[model samples]
Target: RVDFTKIVEEQKSLREDFNKLREDFNKMLLEISELKKGYGRLERRIESTFNAMISGLTDLSKYAGLTLEDFTRKILENYLKGMGVLPSDRSLRSETIDSEQIDIFCEDPAIVGEVTAYAESTKEAEKLLKKASVVRQKLGKEPKKYLLVMTTNKQVYKDIQKISEENEIELIVGRVV
Candidate 1:
């Protein structure tokens, strides 16, 4: 009761449809593989960029004659100027008051500051605070206290920040531009 020619034609059409779908599926798989390879390449590039940046920062820190204090002061000087807080008279004294030296003294603003190359420990932060306290005592005035640190460790930085806040000290963190 079935027509033989019609049945044969239907079988041929079905085979053509299957072939097209299989071809499309293979193309999709190839595209996905290419995308995966591209993603891998992108991830490697990002990691390489980060490593290069860290190395560059390390090299910057090791450069001679540009101590952490010097670097922070250089930046702070510009910042003060921008804030219109320029010192009418800047004094740099090497004299030690109880083994602590005031790194910078601004006459007009009566600002005293301590600078450190690296703040890697709470001990270092305490040392800076002690220096500020000593300067205040020697100056016999409650001069605006400043702590400038080039911090390499996150935990130390946090500790320093907390100490600075408690002591009402202005903390300036130096970093690579």
Candidate 2:
């Protein structure tokens, strides 16, 4: 006599295994999707690196475009006037340092503030650090904090945070507008 009932149970086990295989396939598909996403990110990094390595950018504004000094002045004036950071007793001299300018120079009771503003770029973090170093050297004592405002792009917010944390400097960015 053939054990048909036992054969049916084996078939049921085989069907369960098939379902498990389908779930594994779906998991593999998700992993593949994630890998593709990561690869695309890497491709973008390579492209940006290549562009950075290229020559100077052409001027559309005929050399009348926004300069770093202009940006620094605007940001400092707004912060001092609107934010009450500037003092009437002492003159406020705002300048951009090659390094983070040792934040302390910006904080002297008589010195008002030292700020560096940029339009935001890959070079921002490095520039901020440089300003910090200069401020430190100039002040002999570290300033309370370094204020960095970027009018160019807010995409570098995370980068600003990272550098600020690493250097223990206060980094502020301009609004998206």
Candidate 3:
């Protein structure tokens, strides 16, 4: 016959093990909660940092009276410079190519860019296409052509996208205030 006392002892041991497991699970939950809190704090800090940077940039823009077009032009120039265009090449001092105001023209990478504040009409895309054609003629048929617009509606943006694709122009939209 089996010893009933031994069976009772085994049950007690099992209960102890289950209690320990419950305690460990609770501890893990608490640790996860603490980690979530820490992550929340980190996320807020990052958001605040970006907001401050944007505010600083906005203040500088206001001080310089930079319109949307001007701001976009500046961004294009900086982007070209970042792409390895020299300061002298990216300078606005360069004469307007073909008696038309070309936005950004870098000889090294052979890129010509145009900046517009708004592109809400199909006519805008057409004009940009014409400009790209001229730039291609000047910079050669294979040079990179870009049109950077500050804002556009969804429908108009689609139109512009089609035109750019057909004309082999890179249409970039900048979401800037």
**Which candidate ranks first by lDDT, i.e. highest?**
3
Rank list by TM-score:
1, 3, 2
Residues 86-153, model 3: lDDT tens digits: 46444432236677666666555566666666676767656655655676777675556777665677
Give the TM-score (vs. native) of candidate 2.
Answer: 0.39
The stretch of ten residues in a row with the least summed lDDT in candidate 2 is 53-62
Better of 1 and 3 by lDDT: 3
TM-score of each: 0.53, 0.39, 0.52
lDDT of 1 by residue, 1-177 (tens): 368888888999999999999999999999999999999999768645543543344347567556545545555666576667775345333346686666765644557677765666666557666766676676677767777655447677677778878988876554422
- Whole-model Cα lDDT of every candidate shown, in order: 0.65, 0.52, 0.66
lDDT per residue as tens, model 2, 47-156 = 44432321112122126575544444444444455656656443344554553333223445423233443545536556555655566676666544544453445566
TM-score of 3: 0.52
- In lDDT terms, how accurate is model 3? 0.66
Candidate 1: which stretches are off by over 4 Å?
A: 1-65, 88-95, 175-177
Error of 2 at 168 (Å): 3.7
RMSD of each: 13.8, 11.8, 9.5
Number of the candidate with higher lDDT, 1 or 2: 1
Clash pairs detected, candidate 3:
none
- Superposition error at 158 for model 2 (Å): 1.2
